[model samples]
Target: MSATEDPAAETADDFPAAPPLPWRLDGSARLGVFTLAQPMEAPSTVTAVAARRLLVFANSYRGGDVSYDALGVATLARHRHRVAVVPRHLWVDDPSIRRAGREQASTPSDPGSFAWSDSSARIASGQASVELSWHVRTRLALPMPMTFTYFVWDDGRLGCIPIPGRATGSPITMRINHWPDHFPELAAYESSLALRLNFAMTVRPQRLIDSK
Candidate 1:
């Protein structure tokens, strides 16, 4: 689906009623697999300097091995790009949302809403450091917390990092599911990199913006 599509078009009634509150996966079951549909293209406007200001937040499910765990969702919002992978994490956190069988607590006391805040600072090297606290609703009725820190440098590089809370469960699962329709290209990349590994994504824009 296009990112501009109305989310309301896919309502709860469209799918079977959520199976249950807290879905559970068998400890020994084999996780599923996914492949990226395409490569992600950097926005034309993203410069080396602006790239440093970019931030990304992602959440993955632990099934068997950390390297092969399936990525549940990932989100990035910059001056040029606003993307959500498996946006359910941005709007809802029920186990039934993705059929992963795991549930998180809720936040804002709303079943399908979230709250967030951002802060920035100037470092000694004259670069800017930014941080974002993104909370998602979960079965615990509490926020499943994910923090992201971004460091931008004069040379034009951005560092994106994710720090998940303690309650976050794990051992990465091999298969990833529920790829967000808004970012089919990114989904394809994630699917191809099924193995668990920590790496930074760098984007160099040829143009500052796409008029299209």
Candidate 2:
């Protein structure tokens, strides 16, 4: 019997896992634009929005959502407050991770924040939520470094966050099963490249930057 056929067969434990910078993640992500829509959802706290931004979606064991990061995507925010909606979580587990997110990392005060399911995938906070379905197209590859920039908006201020990581995985296509109503900026379109990844990443300390 196949794992999909057997509900009990699919578990993150069945997938690859690294130390996690103290948090190892196994999940699928989409790195594409809202093809049909632009100016995707910007956290409520962000300044007046213009120009569409890159869209990203990921459902991981750690949990979080995306933002208008010109370069990197913050697909790892589990604590959904109400801003760039930036995030952090725990194994709270990895080494590169301990010093990695030392600046702005945070974990869910409530365990329910990161729980989706064995048969399903999702991550939710107060103002945001994303449900995902992933289809793998390639095999896992050797680990490599990945760097991204996530725009963070919090406490009425916006900043740029630099994230560095090492990862390896298969090519994947993702389907969005659900999204929160507050995030009506993105029109539903399923799947895109990047990878279905096994990785450990760290969020460098952020610097306050003006978003023009």
Candidate 3:
């Protein structure tokens, strides 16, 4: 029998089905406006191995949510800089309900807050690269996949540019995913407001300090 048909050869336990969504959107999601604060930078000499270990440790200790910590480690490892972008203010169009509590509770504690689980490393063109993925929990405990790729050059310089992903789309989509089931329009507007506020919106790598 073919591998597909062979029961012993088939590994049913290896491949599990995905979970279903917990809730569905009743109406257009609300959007909250938020201003991206200045990029916080720190110095480090972290490697891919170190970054992975740091993420593992942070996630274990920090409520199983180490997205931001991973981002910090990745940033530092690749760019020698640890950075964070804080939201200054947030607002919603509908004043009827106060979403501040929910917003704050949902906001990522760090810039790279999505806990990436799977990682693959490779070397190409004289540079070392690592790709990472995370199963994001959205509206319904459903797993929304997210990914990031980092590269390190021969001279030890790390690339810190933010690559486009499912959550890093245009302002509208970005807000939609961030504030699902809420005022997404307001969130889009807030993104624009952040730009107007001269928020250091770009993700920049900071220099790492020598531990020694």
Candidate 4:
């Protein structure tokens, strides 16, 4: 991951006028591995392995409205790109959060519906849904720091942001069941590097990068 942000992309676009400088969020996430689809970011280099992620925010009511934010993400390998794609840009449950995300981070969103239990969860999209059930054995639990750069798109401008945070990661084994036709991006994955986390981070201001 890139350790620092580009000064040029730092203060560009409408990010300076976003709802807030940084949003403090705490949640749990599951990262799953899938088959690498052909024609990746780079044509010359051969690569394998891809990531699909699921995240849930039980409570994010800084303003006093209980909004459950659940997201489905496709974390594609960026080859050698400086700006990487991270989670929370694919599918989301809350419309309010969607509106804020579009302006703040250049995120494209899908309407979501969710249901969950202690051991199982489901996130429903338009016509497709993802069902996850896990019998998890927490082998490790430690304070972890997260650092990643996200590249997003708005109109024609490519936006970027660095999200740095701290969390306690509890890894798990999850069984995911889905139709192949619906989610071709992710293969039928029973387990991968999955984590249940309690995290807190102040989201950084967005940056619009120079294409050339």
Of the two candidates 1 and 2, the one with more favorable TM-score, higher being better, is: 2
- Residues 149-191 of candidate 1: C-alpha lDDT, one tens digit per residue: 2222122332222222222322232322223334333333222
Clashes per model (N, Cα, C within 3 A): 26, 11, 21, 0
What tens-digit string does per-residue lDDT give for candidate 3 at 1-212? 00112223323344332122111111111112333232223233433222211210111112211101121121223334433222221221111111211221221111112223322111111121222222222323222222233332223443232322222211221121222121112212122211000011222222323323
TM-score of 3: 0.17
TM-score of 1: 0.24
Better of 1 and 3 by lDDT: 1
Off by over 4 Å in 4: 1-18, 37-67, 77-83, 86-89, 179-182
lDDT of 4 by residue, 108-132 (tens): 5665677778877777766767677
TM-score for each prediction? 0.24, 0.49, 0.17, 0.71
Please report how far candidate 1 places residue 53 from its true position, in Å. 19
In model 4, residue pairs whose N, Cα or C atoms come closer than 3 Å (at least 3 residues apart or on different chains), thus clashing, are none
lDDT of 2 by residue, 22-120 (tens): 332333333433432544334443432333433454434343221111111223222234223233221112222222333243221111134444334
Off by over 4 Å in 2: 1-33, 40-54, 59-119, 124-129, 153-158, 209-212
